[model samples]
Target: MALTFLFRFADDVVEASDGSLYFSVASTKFGLHDWFFDVLEANLPHGQLLKYDPALNETSIVLNGLCFANGVALSVDQDYL
Candidate 1:
């Protein structure tokens, strides 16, 4: 199913060779209005990397416990995260 929850802090997205989408979430504990603290101090490593598989209409948590994960880009050949 499609994502029913608003991402806490979706910062970036990139399309994969398989047509899936990879994105970044700055912090799950804070929104855009107050994300500064999450990155600045209050919370560290609250970021996450998500993957959306349109073919299956599903979204999965690919990675977590990241430190303010802001920008995300898949490696060439889509071999690495």
Candidate 2:
């Protein structure tokens, strides 16, 4: 039998009060052999900022292709969100 795996690399994350989670995923390429070597070739990790709202049970992409977007924070008023 063949086995399958799901690999996800998350660099940073933040949570919102409305039961929402925001995070960034870094770009990575891998092979069966010496996968760690690929990390060096990743250069600039490009990915999107995602928001998962548990109340609505939906995941939305707030921003895309943000290079090196490591942290996220909401506005003080929360109204701007």
lDDT per residue as tens, model 2, 1-81: 422223244566777777788876553233335435445555644555777778877667777655545567778866644
List the candidate 1 regions with Cα displacement exceeding 4 Å: 1-4, 40-44
The clash count for each model shown is 0, 0
RMSD of each: 2.3, 6.7
lDDT of residue 68 for candidate 2: 44
Candidate 1 total steric clashes: 0
Best by TM-score: 1
Q: What TM-score, computed on C-alpha atoms, does each candidate reach?
A: 0.82, 0.58
Instruction: Give the clashing residue pairs of candidate 1, or none.
Output: none
